[model samples]
Target: MKICVFGTGAIGSHLAGRLAKGGAELSVIARGSQLAAIREKGITVRAPDGELHCMPRAAADPAELGPQDAVLVTTKQTALPSVAGTIAPLLGPDTSVAFVVNGIPWWYYDSEGGPNQGTRLPQVDPGDAMRKAVGIERTLGGVVWSACTVTEPGVVEVRSPTSRLILGEPDGTVSARAQAIADILKAGGLGAKAVPDIRTELWAKLIGNLSQGPLCVLSRQDMKTTLADPAVREAALRSLNESIAIAAGLGIKLEINAEDRFARSVNTAHKPSILQDLEAGRPMEVAAIFDLPLLLARQAGVETPTLDLCVALARQTAAAAGLYQA
Candidate 1:
């Protein structure tokens, strides 16, 4: 299979390296120093399991690489508008566009069968740009669980010992396309699975971000450090419960223990990506990761006092730092 990873940052670089190692014909859309490094030295992934180096085709322009069997969009939500502008060149009639990023996806309501079905989240998509560009039929949802960082340009460091990527179709079908992408990721040594109910997986992954992301951004610390305080940990629990409640209001039941999940991340040194963006002076992902969840909670009539406060403070911090507009 041929794959083009759009936005080869930390996670995307690691994934593209793995796919190349797994024997798929791979290419990447990249820019700036990272693109130059990948063109000169290829992409490198440093993980506990091993290290990998591979030179798939690298280009800043999507048209330089052409269409592929799949296009994995791993760019942050802040970059989605630009992605919408450039991604058209990377699609064929049968290309699968999997958004392997964080927080609630813009395609969340596309396949949901109910009153909320076909709803567009302007916070995430901003005037149906992605919906109009990618369309519903070729779209897929992806949730990934690897803690990764760019050690340098063209280099990705995988901090987690265990990593997994879950993919699913919008309509809850057991899709051959999802399975095929999962197979490539699994072959590259990540635990990959295709699920029928991806919204549940989305809620499950989202709980962790809701629990820690805003807190970390506020504290300017990693998960292990920021979650060290008893008060902080308790607040994290409240945030998780509220988010879980929001998911329940939306009819997605997540069966994870809130406290246990908090406990598990107490020793993780990974800084939330939103915090990374804030510290780097780049645009923070407040809209998708923090704001959208709160919006959905309001829509569901779920009360999230703790989330509301943290997100407000986090948004303020981002604005004061000049990294976030709203």
Candidate 2:
């Protein structure tokens, strides 16, 4: 299968290396120094067990790569507007686009069957931009569990021993291509699965994100340092609980306990992506990652006092620094 990884940053580069290891025909859309490094020395994945080096077809322009069997988008949520039109060149008739980033996705409501069934999240996909270009029928849901950092251009360092990925169709149906993509990742020594209920898995992953993302942004520290103080731990727990309540109110059952999830993330020394964006002085994901979830809480009649306060403060801090827009 010809697979393209859009925005080949830390997670994207790691994922691209896995696909390249599986010996699939792969291409990557990267820019600047990262693109130069990939062209010179191939994309590198540094893992706990072993290091992987795979030279993929890299390009700055999506049209240069053309259509693909599948596309995995791993950039920051706010970067979507800049690359909105550029993504079209990667679409084929049956191509699937998998967004492997955090927070409520653009296609979140496509298969949502409840009180808010088929209700679109304008905050995530404002003005129908994503839906117009990449229709909901061709979209896939992705959830990834990996701790990674880009130490340098084209170099991805994996901090953990195990990383997992889950893929599913928007409507929760099993797809042959989803399983095939999962098989490819498994072959490359990653835990990849095709699931029937991607929403549950999304909320499970999101609970961790909800606790760490805003705290890290506020503390200006990685996961370990920010969750160090007993007081901070309590705050993280409160945020997690509120997120879990919101998810349950949306009719998604999160199998894991919110506190357990927060505790599990306490040891990771990696900086949350939101923190990374803040330090990099890039556009931060305020709406999709933080706001839209709270927006859903309001829509679902869920009271999220803790989450509301923290996320608002974090957004204001980012906005004050001009790293995020309202």
Candidate 3:
């Protein structure tokens, strides 16, 4: 199958290398130094398993790559508007567009069914650009468990011992298209699955982001270091409980033990991606990873006091740095 990976950052580059190694006809939409490096040296991923190197077709314009069987959008939420404007050239009649992003997706309410069905997240989508560009019929929900970073242009370092990608249809059906993409990712040595409940997977990952991301940004330290403080650890536990409560209010009860989760996170040395962006002076995912969850909590009438405080401070930090406006 032919696949195109949009936004060849850390996660995108890692997935692109896997797709190339998996023997799919692969291509990438990239820009700046990363694009030049990929065109010159392909993509190099230093993973815990081993080093992988592959050169897929690299282009700055989506039109240059044409339509594909599938397109995985690995860009941050901040870039989605621009992607929507340019992504049309890469979609075919039956092509699937999987948004393998963090936090709550913009398509969270589409096909969700019920009173909240069709609700729009203007913060994430901004004028329904993505909804119009990639219709729900061709959209897939994806969640990835990979702690990675691009050490240099076209080269990524995977810090996690294991990485996995989960894909599913928004309407909760196991479709052939989602399975095909999962198979390609698995063939490249990454653990990939096509599940029936992608939203559950999303909330599970999001709970971790909520508990760790804001604190890491405030402390300016990695998870292991920041979470080592007992006081902060307790706060994190409260945040975790509140996040789970928010999810439960949304009708998705996540079976996560706060202590057990922190026990594992306290050993992780990698910094959260939002912290990385703040340090690099790039735009952080304040709205998607932090703000949106709080918004959902308010909508569900779930109180998230600990999360509210941490997120407020983190948002201020981002805004003060001129990275985030609100």
RMSD of each: 0.9, 1.2, 0.8
Q: Residue 139: error of model 3 in Å?
A: 0.4
lDDT of 3: 0.93
**Which candidate wins on lDDT?**
3
RMSD of 2: 1.2
lDDT (Cα, tens digit) per residue for candidate 3, span 1-326: 99999999899999998888888899999999999999999999999999999989999999998999999999999999999999999999989999999989999988887579989999999999999999889999999999999999989999999999999999999999999998888999999999998999999999999878999999999999998999998998899889889899899977887778878998999999889999999888899999999998999999999999999999999999999987
- List ranges where model 3 is wrong by over 4 Å: none
Better of 2 and 3 by TM-score: 3
Q: What total of clashing residue pairs does each candidate reach?
A: 0, 0, 0
The sequence of per-residue lDDT tens digits that candidate 1 reaches over residues 1-326 is 99999998888998897888778899999999999999999999999899989998999999998889999999998899899988998899899999998888899998799689988888889888988899889999999888889989989999989888899999999799999988988889988999999989988988888868999999999999998998998898899899899999999988888777878889899898889898889898888888888898899999999999999999999999998886
Candidates 2 and 3: which is better by lDDT? 3
User: What Cα-based lDDT does every candidate model obtain?
Assistant: 0.90, 0.87, 0.93
Model 2 lDDT vs. the true structure? 0.87
| Rank ordering of all candidates by lDDT, starting from the highest | 3, 1, 2
